[model samples]
Target: MRTSRFAVTVTAVLALSALLSPFGTGSAQAAASTVSPTGTNNWSCKANAAHPNPVVMVHGTYGDMTVWNTMGPALVNAGYCVYALNYGSQATASMVTSAGELKTFVDKVLASTGATKVSIVGHSQGGTMPRYYLKNLGGAAKVNDMISISAANHGTTNTGVTAKMVGYPTCVACSQLMSGSSFLASLNATDETPGTVSYTNIVTSYDKVVTPYTSGYLSGPSTTNIKLQDDCPADTASHTQMPSDPAVIRLVGNALATNGPAQATYKAKCTW
Candidate 1:
């Protein structure tokens, strides 16, 4: 079932999200200002009343917040107070450890901005691990929205092999991403997307990390599943390229327009 596709400009997307935001103060200053990538925040920046929910960018396994360099500034330029953190950076770090890190960082964002909640933008393991925090570590109440790019949600296979046989003793996170892993099983045991937290999964058919791409799909109320090539058949964005892929960026922007940009899905055409 195909629906109408509208290519709303990024500015319009942010504007719409702001309007539907629970924190917009209708101030001209916050709605239009931009944050430099090197700007000193120290969490001192106040949440834009128009878009009060600060956005926290989480990185994937063996990756850090620097990965968001391409996407973070874009959000800041769009008038959002952006933040990013590195979790599960260690090979031995359990998913619970990363989830705890997320909780702590989220609390800091809330307190720093004096805001009650935040929106999460995670990539790869960045996307997969947060759900554990939300599902088991009491994170649903703090997150307003979650946008996962290439998440290992339902678990994936290791080069067509199951986790049970993939050198599990070395990389804990790797084992967890495989299908049938106890970590993944318990993570999906309850409602995948709980509360009013809107969930969006931006996956790529060219994904090699999250094999069988379908494993990344998240289902729940207000949850949307977007295949980078579904609408743009020409798109060849790989799992590693999603953060910088123009098409993926736009899709994420539309998803962030949670309040009232009825035109969230856009027409995309990318080649090579």
Candidate 2:
């Protein structure tokens, strides 16, 4: 059973990597040369009254800052200062250490933009890892909004595969994402939503990586959990594709525009 699960896990990881390679690497490299498609790592951007908080984009497992090539440009066009960073060696490092790295990057963003607080937009592991920064590393005070795309906020059911794989030294972060892992337990022990930060989780029904997609939902005040199908029934975006999904970006923008979480009444457009 263990070997079978490991094989499945490896296949899934490989498939996802292949699926993302074209967009994650090819388009990222091309976008790196252009200014309109990608606007990340702009240190000179300043916050304006219309969009007081600068936006920070975070990527998921096996991902780099380039993962935001689509969403980063969208936010920048919407009149927000956007920034992204590569952390945890493509997010395979210890989550605790990644959270600390996040804190450092956010501090730099705040200082560079002269903004008191910023909004966070993250995908997959990127979404859940920032909670550690908020809860433990004094990030809550520095953040106003957190928009998560397909995050495993409560962990995933693939523990059978990742649990055994963590025996190796290379993937310590993988085990922490398994359901009921020590790291998740500690993260959700007291308050799933800490500080004054508003939490918005935008999840898709077709996410194979984070099985039982509802696991992305958080239980706390100022938290809004949204299922893509609830608003856009025809949407069938997978876990890895959620970041680039147009409907997901719309919802993320809506959440950032509001004072609290996304409005329960907001309906998403069914766009591929």
Candidate 3:
């Protein structure tokens, strides 16, 4: 049963990828912008009093604050106070253990923004890692909304290749760590979307890194998990591009709109 389910999930992800292939890819130049700090090393701006909560952008593994350079300015121009950070540094490994570091960053954001809570937008691991802070580090009460872009909430099997090359134990350990293990299960038990905070998961069918993209889903009444092609019929953005895709951005903007529906539709060609 487990193997069949895993296969079906993988097939779904591949189908989504094929659906997104024609959208074209994103460029670093296209998404690049100059980032200025509001105060000290903290990147901040005055929150529109009407929208009191600041928005913090968290990048995935092997990424820095620059990932959101373009997106941040767009949010700021739209009247949101935006911030970004680099976390989960490992001397031996690349990008891992990011969730464990989120609590510290959340505290820093709170201190810099002077807001009781903030909205978080993360890509890849950045998306699901905050759930750790939300559930374990008192983040549930401090976060107003969480927007995860192609986050690996359930874990990926592609890690098996690295495990084979590096050693069985290393790859197995990494996959187990990302996937919902006992620790993650414990966190989920707290409440899928706890407190007054709203949760939004935005995923692309074409994500190659986070295999079996359904792993990105969050099951909760207050949580929304959206597949991008559903919102824009012509959108075919891959995993890496989802963060910068114009269609995805529009969906995110609409999701952030106060008057928008808690539930929205996303359509895509599917194969199993």
81-149 in candidate 1: lDDT tens per residue? 788765554322578888898899899989999888888888877788989888878888888888898
Q: In lDDT terms, how accurate is model 2?
A: 0.77
Per TM-score, the best of the predicted structures is 2
Of the two candidates 2 and 3, the one with more favorable lDDT, higher being better, is: 2
lDDT winner:
2
For each candidate in turn, the TM-score is 0.79, 0.84, 0.71
What would the per-residue lDDT of candidate 2 be over residues 125-186, giving only the tens digit for each residue? 88999999999999999999988998888888864324322213365677788788999999
| Candidate structures ordered by TM-score, highest first | 2, 1, 3
Looking at model 3, report the run of 10 residues with the lowest lDDT sum.
18-27
* Cα lDDT for residue 44, candidate 1: 74
Judge candidate 1 at residue 212 and give its lDDT: 76
Worst 10 residues of 1 by lDDT: 19-28
lDDT, ranked from best to worst: 2, 1, 3
Worst 10 residues of 2 by lDDT: 21-30
Give the whole-model CA lDDT for all candidates, comma-separated.
Answer: 0.67, 0.77, 0.58
Clashing pairs in 1: 23-49, 24-49, 24-50, 25-49
In model 2, what are the clashing residue pairs, if there are any? none
Candidate 1 off by > 4 Å: 1-42, 90-92, 159-169, 260-264, 268-272
Using TM-score as the measure, name the better of candidate 1 and candidate 3: 1
The residue pairs that clash in candidate 3, if any, are 17-206, 20-236, 230-266, 230-267
